[model samples]
Target chain A: MKKLSETKEKRSNLSKRIWADRQLYFMLIPFLLFYVIFVYKPMWGLQVAFKDYNIFKGMSGSPWVGFENFKTIFGNPYFFRILRNTLLISTYSLIFSFPMPIILALLLNEVRIRKFKSLVQTCTYLPYFISTVVVAGMVTSFLAPSTGMVNLILAKLGFEKIYFLSKPEYFRTIFITQGIWQNAGYSSIVYIAALGGIDMELYDAAMVDGCGRWKQTLHVTLPGLLPTIVTLFIISVGNILNVGYEKIILLYQPATYETADVISTYVYRLGVEQANYGVSTAMGLFNSVVGFVFVYAANKISNKINGMGLW
Target chain B: MTMRTRGEKIFGIFNAILLTAIAMVCIYPFIYILAVSLSDAKSVNMGAVWLLPKGINLNSYSQIVHKEGIWTAYLNSFFYMFMGTAVSMALTTLGAYALSKKRLVGHRFLNLFVVFTMWFNAGMIPMYLNFKNMGMLDNRWAIIFGFAINTYNFVILRTYFANVPQALEEAAKIDGASDFKVLLKIYLPLAVPSLATVALFYAVERWNSYFWPMILLKSDSKIPLQVVLKKMVVDMSSRMDSLNYGRDMTGTSEDGFIYSTMVIAMIPMLILYPFIQRYFVKGVMVGSVKG
Candidate 1:
């Protein structure tokens, strides 16, 4: 008799639990509607890469092109050049820009005074908030190779003024170093947060072992922030193909296109400026695929090594 | 006891100097621009105004304010940011809540679907053409809907919701509260900081956005501030013919006002960032810890 009563009561409770969450479920409806309409439905249009699309005829009426656009992109004379520039610039940025934030965070962590630390942080992040156009414009004006401040200083110091923007050799260096200056401080915030969250007990233990500040930072702080570092690294890999069209467009001209013109800027020129939709779409699709692959590979490796990744 | 010897002392000072120098390198150039913008045109052109304004003035700022499309661009950017943030926040919160529930129907499938898009996009041209077909191309709504649910933000939000103590919901249930009531009464209040952070994240992303806006916002009338900023950077007189964009007081080219326009584009975010800074890092990146 007791068992029977308990079973009946449990069943009633289960039903109540299931039915009680209706409004919560109701709130989720619009988001589901949004994804279905925008993301999912549009995924069907990926077929356009294979089709000879016409603005007037539209997707349904367009003739099947079947790898023609892809073929043309591959056959294009400048495909290799653009691809190389994209890879080189991304690689340069990755090498220089990736590690500066971690190091900045470490340096910031050592400062005992709160006000000074914050001032350092504030000063660093200010550059990031400045518009990319202005950053590029500043870069242009500063690197004018003669009258610009850099050259002015160079001339004072008895060095020849190197034309930073117009020279292909100097373009990647200027882009990467300036990229570091603009973003390293802002990016350090993530690592700083991670560092801040590390258990104080770990540092205490390290100190008990006679570990120096450098040793504690190397052993404790670095490892504690490892997960954040890994995740950000993977996300950045996914973004490698996104070579910031606005700044690049502003910085590049016919003279520097040899090294500076990347896939994003190239697509903007051909697609938006020239209005050739098909080839630019092919180029964009190409960028997405490569980015997707890099992200996937990085995540997989990170998962294998640390059991932490974007996946 | 002597571990912190003379070498250690030197290292510490060296580290401090390097970092402080780096900090100045990051900051001083922009300050130079600010100085130049406020300086008299003669001093600015001659590079005398690198650190300080030659003649203190507010003319440059007023000149940009008086530009034709500048105000419209500001309004357009706000419309996209405000409306876009509202829709994005609503969807992300609800989607997160739904998925956070362990007993919810089809939760696994939904999670998988969201994550799949993160790894593989449907590519840009398709996204653009799709927006075109849905009568949304060239629409701010198109921009709004294009990035409605970022998987990263979705996961962060879910982490926040999932961390909400289950007992709170259970007690609310015992009180005859619906799931909606529990979410509203309990979760929303607790999740305010996270919501503010993520909302700021969405706002920043929407504000800083340019590429898709470049594709979708074909209409000149609907251009966002970032797009206009881009045009100005590319060409000084992109929106203004050089004739029309001249300085108000001195009657020279609007070089004085260029920095002013860029500054105007930046002000809204700057004003909004500090208020949310307290919660920004923790609230948003808490989702990152789920990895």
Candidate 2:
């Protein structure tokens, strides 16, 4: 009977030891508080997707509409167009813009002059801090077509001036170019840091083996940068619907809506401009699902290829 | 080390010219706006302003300072930036610290739940409705409350926590230090670089936020600098006939005032930049790879 009592005491002691450290648990309190109060609490309102949500009616009192909102958004012909634009722009951006910073990082890594490299980096990154309002301003000012400097230069070269912003044909070019200009330098910093972490001993061995700069870069630097690149790629894929509607809203006029209108801008209109909460939430949920699938798939592929995943 | 080859030297020269040209193109608009803002209104109207100003004047800046409601806008922005960034940093650090522990039960679930919110969101109307329900509408906390701690920053903060040597936390543990004590006293002090980077990130994001402010803030007085900038750029084109820059009440053309307002909009960012400029790229890099 005494031995059994001792065993029970020992078992409780073992269970207590296995429990999460109290101090660690204490540190997590504020974290849980924040998410619960803000995030998880707000998540309850997500039920509004199934309800006809009116401000005065409130979430609780709002009548359940079932799949009506989703049906409404899905039934609209404009839905496919916005989805197509979102997918197309994100796909192109991933293909073209994703590789640019990698190339820029490679070029920067090869630059022997530290001053020049830093200067180039600073120059490239300058545009990012320029507000979207200002960037759009610059885009219009630079691509004015008639009196603009770009057109003037093009005219000097004996080519017809292109009304880039006003025309649907030139919309993607302007968007992608501005995006590359704004992001390339800022994006390359991660790759540069990754390159920095490459062990010096590895480089020294490659040198002893008589590998030149190009060979060293291919064999040593590129391999080291792979994980960082994969991570960034996964993140970018995660934001598949993040077409950054602010710039598009500021820049796009009715003439270029065919190319310029994305899921976010559409949401802004259906939500803010038109005041359709249910449709907007449904649309937002749709975008979220697509974005989630991409991130999930991207992580899976990355893990398969290189043993690197978001997890 | 071998010297750059003859072809390499030429390539370097070509790269230098290309980069410089791109830099000038990137940088010159702000300079142009600056010169345009400083130039005499007549010079600006005729597009006479060049790389250098025709005249140097603080008329635009002073006029904005003197305007009836402009000070309110400045105050609104300041209140938002100062309180918003501080709260964000604190919440992010504490939350991230807690989540970074592998031993913490439910860590994986917590992570999945948080990261899920990043991609999926309730759209603007739902969010607005959500805010109104919570009594955040027209409140300064509306902006602050909605995004006090970004998940991306939380991830970076968690990564920094993961990086602290386990043995160090254990030693502190052996000394009978509580979790909060070790986090506040030991971990935070050691993680200055990450903390600074995250703080800068939040500060910049909060400062640059326009859409939320435009949505949640109904009063013009509550609008931030970006909102004002948007008005000057977009609404100004439509409302150009309403403004006159000088005493004649017709003294300056709409173009002159528009350019002046554009330049005025840039001043805050420029002023606030030097303080956090060094950390800007480093912050992005950390948030990108590790986040």
Candidate 2 clash pair list: none
TM values, all candidates: 0.88, 0.87
Error at A154, model 2, angstroms? 6.6
DockQ of 1: 0.40
List where candidate 1 sits over 4 angstroms from the true fold: A1-22, A144-148, A155-163, A197-211, A217-239, B1-3, B237-252
TM-score of chain B of each: 0.89, 0.89
Alpha-carbon lDDT, every model: 0.76, 0.74
Best model number under lDDT: 1
lDDT of 1 by residue, A1-311 (tens): 99999999998877776565566567768877877777777667766767777889887898988889889889988889898999889878888889999999998898766887888887787676555666776786676543457866776798876666667888888888878888888888878988888999998899899888889889999899988887788778767877766677777777788999888788778766776667778778788788888878887887887787776
- Interface root-mean-square deviation for each candidate? 4.9, 5.1
Question: On residues B20-54, what C-alpha lDDT tens digit does candidate 2 reach at each position?
Answer: 67667667777877776677776654445668888
Docking class of 2: acceptable
Instruction: Flag regions of model 2 displaced more than 4 Å.
Output: A1-30, A141-164, A199-227, B103-105, B166-177, B237-277, B288-291
For each of the candidates, give the backbone clash count: 0, 0
